[model samples]
Target: MELEGKVVVITGGSSGIGLATARMLLEKGATVVSWSRSRPKISHPDFYFFECDVRHEHSVWAAYEQTEERLRQNISVLINNAGLGIQGALDTMSPKDWLTMMDTNVNGIFYCTRLVLPGMKRMREGHIINVSSIAGIMGSENLTGYCASKFAVRGLSEALYKEVRDYGVKVTCLYPGSTDTGFFDNFEGVTSRENMMQPQDIAATIVHALQSPPNFHHVNIEVRPLMPKGPKSPKKA
Candidate 1:
């Protein structure tokens, strides 16, 4: 669909990928509404900011409702980017932390998607982009809970893609690896921010997916850094 003047809703828009996406979408002539628990200072005239906690169903509903009323348009695109990361060995991680991961990453997507489905079906045209992670595709040693949550997110995206394809809605899932975002602060291991992907890069990919032709529905895209080759053995001795 043409992005010009289209209304797009993005969750977790205070920072990271969502923020970057909001800016990019604005550049593409889309009217963008961004939701977060804390509102960030965005300077764009076309960008509307909404404070919302996606983990709470009411918060998600209110944000969308307000956006719809103000914009006078059902959302043409919904980007599910609200996520949390809790890192530790599964045995060492607290039950609360595990539940937090599931609530924010899994249940949050479920709530937002459920609210948007009706409008999308009625219009017979919409896009849903769920931000997953490389950990969703490959397991990590200390990030068991996070991995599980992201894996569930990817699964949900796939299921929704199948269910919504018949309704003229496109569902795209993204698996970005170790992005240089707040997510790294939760990890206990060494983190080189420079080595990881940037939020802007992932946001660009999301926009590309949004612009993709209807005949080419890229349901899933896995993004990762180039793997380092092993050290040469002393030049073959």
Candidate 2:
């Protein structure tokens, strides 16, 4: 779909990938609405900020409703970028932490997607982009809960893709690997930001996906950094 003058809704737009995406989309002439619990640091004439907690259905509904009412148009794109990652061994993980991860990463997407689908279906032209992670594709030792949440996102995106294809609403699941964001701040595993992809890189990929012809749909995209090879070990004396 053409981006100019289109209405786009993005969750978790306060920072990181979501914020970067909002800037990029705005540059393309799309009207951008950002939903998050906290206010984002961006200010643009075409950018609208809505405080919302995607984990709650009512909050998600209100955010979308207000956007539609204000814009008087159906959303052209819905980007589910709000998520949380808690890393720890399964036995060491707290139930509250587990629930938080599931609620934010899994249920949040469901709430936002459910609210946006009817509008897109009515218009028969829209795109839904879910920001998942490479952890969803492969299991890691310390990311059991995080993996579970992201894996659920992958499943939800895949099923929703097939369900919405006939309606002219495309679904794209982004599985980005180790981007240099605060997502790794509380992570217990080793973090090498120097070798990680930048948030702008993911934003560019998302813009590229959105720029695809209406006839083409990219169901899934995985992005990873090109890490330099470690030095070879010398022969033992």
Candidate 3:
């Protein structure tokens, strides 16, 4: 599909992967719409930002309506990139924190995808990318809630593609490795932030996927840096 003048909506466009992807897409000549609770520090003629909290269905729906109304165009692509992570044992986790993680990581995707699917199906041409985590593939200690949410995303993406493929819509579930995007801010002492993948790395992969042939259906792609830094790393390396 041509990226030129394509309408792409990205959640959490204020920072990290979403921000990087938004900038990259804009560079590719795609009109970018940012749906984020926090405003982004981006300035471009083709770039627009809308304040949205994806956790609430109404908030997502309203933002979608307003964005399309303003652009006067149907979304050609959707990136459910807004995600939150809380690391704790279930018994030690607070209800508020857990809910925040679940709502942001899982429910947000549901709401955003739901709002855009009918339009995408009607158009019979669209792409949806759901950002999961490596934890979604492998469980980790003291990170059960975060893992569960990412795993749910994997499941959703797997089922989503089968449901939408015949309609010419593509669904991709991305499992990205630890990136130094303040995603580690919630964890006290885990890994060296400088040793992880960069947001631009993930952003580049997303752009490459978008540049694929129209018939190409990317079901799931896992990206990890070589010699990934773990919770306990030797100082020498």
Candidate 4:
């Protein structure tokens, strides 16, 4: 679909991949409505901002309503990018942490998708991209809650893709390798802060998928950095 003049809504737009994507989409001539709980310094004429918590249904609904009121158009693209991570072994993690991860990573996608579908159905065209993670596809030692939540998101986005493809709505779940984002702020590890994908690279892939033709339903895409084949080297070359 052509992004020019399209109304696209992205969550977690204050920083990281979402903010980068919003900037790129705006450059491509799309009207961007970015939602974040915390505001950022934005200076784009075509970009609109909405402060929202995706975990809250009321906040999600209110943000969308405000988008419609401002743009006078149903959303052509919905990017569910808001997520948080908590790191700990399953036995060590608190119940509160698990619930928080589930609510934000899993249920938040459901809430936003449920709210956006009716509008897409009425319009008969839309794209939904769920930003999953490599953790969603693989298991890790200390990230039990985070892995579970992202895995559920991957499953939800896949199932929803099958259900919505014939309706002119495309659903894609992107599994990005760890990127330099606040996503690692909760984790403590040697490799957590480095040796991962870049947010701009992921954002470029998203724009490519969004612009793909309807005949190409390239649904689930997993992106990871290429690891060295040789023995441990001092530097990556």
**Pairs that collide, model 1:** none
Worst 10 residues of 2 by lDDT: 224-233
**Candidates in order: C-alpha RMSD to true structure:** 2.3, 2.4, 2.8, 2.7
Each model's TM-score? 0.93, 0.94, 0.95, 0.93
Better of 3 and 4 by TM-score: 3
Candidate 4 deviation (Cα RMSD): 2.7
Write the residue-wise lDDT of candidate 2 on 32-52 in tens digits.
Answer: 999899988888899998889
lDDT of 3 by residue, 1-237 (tens): 799999999999999999999999999999999999998888999999888999898899889989988999889899999998888998999989888989999999999998889988999999999999999999998898999999999999999999999998999999998887978886877666767999999999998888889888778999998767555655995
Looking at candidate 2, what is the lDDT of residue 74? 82
Model 1, range 43-78, lDDT digits (tens) per residue? Answer: 877889888998888988898888888888888899
**The candidate that achieves the highest lDDT relative to the unseen native structure:** 3
Candidate 4 local lDDT, 1-237, one digit each (tens): 999999888888889999889888998999888878987557888899988998888998898788878888888899999999888899989999999999889888887889888888777789999999999999999989999999998889889988888888999999998687777775675463556667888899999999998778768999976651323658868
Runs in model 1 deviating more than 4 A are: 227-237
Candidate 3 lDDT score at position 220: 93
**Cα lDDT over the full model 1:** 0.87
Off by over 4 Å in 3: 230-237
